[model samples]
Target: MKNIFFILLSLVFTSITYAHEGGHGTPTKNWSFVNNNETIKADFIMKVGDMVYLSNENNEVLTFNYSEFKEQDQNYISEKANFINNLNFTKESHRLKTFDYSILLLLTGILVFVFSLFSWKTKPKKYFVTYNLFSASLIMMGCANTKSSKVLKMAANDIPFLESVFGVFNKVNTRHDDQYFYVESDGIPEHEMMTGITNWQQQVPVDHDYSGNNAWAIPLQPELAENTLSTKENFMKGAIAIAVNGIPIFNPLNNRGEDANVIGELDKWGGHCGRADDYHYHLPPTHLQTKVGEDRPIAFALDGFAVYGETTEELDENLGRFTSDSTYQYHAVKKYPYLIAAMKGKVELNPRTQAPENEIMPQAKTRGVRPDLRPLRGAEIIDFENPEPHQYSLSYTVNSQIHKINYGWDTDGNYNFEFVNPDGTTEKSHYKRN
Candidate 1:
């Protein structure tokens, strides 16, 4: 009786040892090879370093250096190696290991029954249930631990900040692949068009497909150009930047090399419909602050720089500056070159219409020109004198000739104007305030 009890105890410990060392089988696939001019089949284990491990039909393990294979076989194994490297082994092994726990619990129950036959001085029934439950709990913990590692790895690759920023724009869809960050839209503004335009008769806003072949994408990482291109002459044409609302912003200067604002072409929103029926902005859309907030970016340049509505710090001539985090950005100004006066980053040069020599008029050399008024089409303020409240005398150049105009409220609140030409002739006009 004593000998039999010792034998059973030794077997129980040995079974538990094997259970921990030998896990459930891993996934295997059939592998074929030619031996002695005969095709041989075996179960493939895995590629370990530079060698492939296999198990023959009789369960004999075999190892072969990858270089020992024929050229054709080497190519086949190389492709399979890539597949095995990227496989999600953590989850797959967890499932198989959990199934092993069931088998372990069953063997533990049998061991308890055999031990009970040898000695029953203690409560055998109570111990049997307790051991089985503990074994099952361990399997659950193993599976949870394995899945958590994969979840954490995926989280590390997510870019949440970019996802949140792009979510703010309407009709804006963004995606990323290996090379570029793509932004797709129909190039339409969310705000009302053709509103508050004095010259809407000449141009009406129209809908454009602006989809498919017109879809725009920017490089995932922006690289600076050797030298920034100036927005002067005919450098900037077509779409230089894209507003968050999906509209394309062109150069502030219209096709004729004239300011769209003074030409009475752009609406109060600083945008107008192009010849392609594409509505776009010539100046910064300052009114966007009411909708998109002053602190947020209003647009993105083709070079992948964010265009903010306003910035407190002084910026370069291009209305661009580096942020606190050293990120380059362009902001809108309240002057002639309102948005960008030049491409602040790298850009592909597109063709632009040449300005005729007659269209490029010279500035006035005889007077002090206002920096703010010089770019206004056919108009420039030379001097201004205010003699009283709401009364002023002004000298301005229009159509390349200087003119003097004096206007104030008469006793009856009627405004009167006296216009003096450069040749010394005067014209008088009056208007009654309603």
Candidate 2:
């Protein structure tokens, strides 16, 4: 009986062991190759006992029990699944809801503050504190709302800009890239060689060849000119032009051209100035053209300020031989506010047949002249009084035709000009004459 009982006990113990290992089957041993360039070889070994061992021929061994490996694997899988699920749903809806809430809060705060203004029984000190707190809250809420909108816009616009800017580089840098486009010219394209505009290709003339003066000049249409002269349009154009032109555009009242210099100084101190790269001369010379005919000498002017190249002996001679006391250099002054304001649409140019009353005739001024008015070191001047009385004709050549530009500032300190073709046909720019 004792022997039979012992046999039964041994059989029971064997059955229990078999049951524990049922799903696991045999003592399975497997190896997986994880070919890593960083190491000679990384191999994972698993045994039936739920033991995992990681071996890298070039490094030390890492070992983990079955439970630990299983837990880590499960965690990784869960995280990946969650990420995929989130991507499937639209996250923008939540962002929009948050933005709308911020906007509503801002508006509500403003309304409450405004209504508080009419309250009659409030103590002065208490009222002041309350008003300030309320105003601050309103401002914060408004800032939050603006931030949300800006973020959304950046998200939408950033991708396209990145692709446009970097895609070209990637295609050219990668080999076997036959699908890419190459820009060809006799030499490097003029726009490529020029360093001003961020996206010069967008503004470049598509239908014209850029080999000569025609390439340098842009055409002026009545409607386009009208649009460009509008307060917002003018400001935007000027801002964009300055940004791309790599030059400072200034306001007439502030005729101090020092902003550009200040910006350069800041850059030396590790500060970021404008978005565009720095490229301004302390006193850049004006661009000049040789006389083509007996007609008026064509000169390119911005606002009412004429562009002049550096004074050479010939230029000095042309200025009627002024002595040292009378000799003065012409500076390219940028009008930032006028250009920026025009860009912002706050102002408009009204084109009309009637001339501006504030128009200062070029011929009325003298040669070798400087403005008698003292401008602060950096102030921008739209028009300077010619110290020397001299008559000069002005015209802009665009699309292979020369159109005379009428020069003067409006009463409100805006540019007023017209284009006259060789045939004597004149078209006005859009800036309402005061």
Question: Which stretches of candidate 1 lie above 4 Å from their native place?
Answer: 1-162, 351-434
User: Cα RMSD to native, each candidate?
Assistant: 23.0, 29.5
lDDT of 2 by residue, 19-51 (tens): 342132232323322332232233443221223
lDDT of each: 0.57, 0.29
Number of backbone-clashing residue pairs for each candidate, in the order shown: 0, 48
Q: What would the per-residue lDDT of candidate 1 be over residues 231-349, giving only the tens digit for each residue?
A: 65543356666676667677787766777777676766788766543578888776766766777777767777778887778665466886655467789878666777666666654
Output the number of the lDDT-best candidate: 1
TM-score of 1: 0.43
- Estimated TM-score for each candidate: 0.43, 0.20
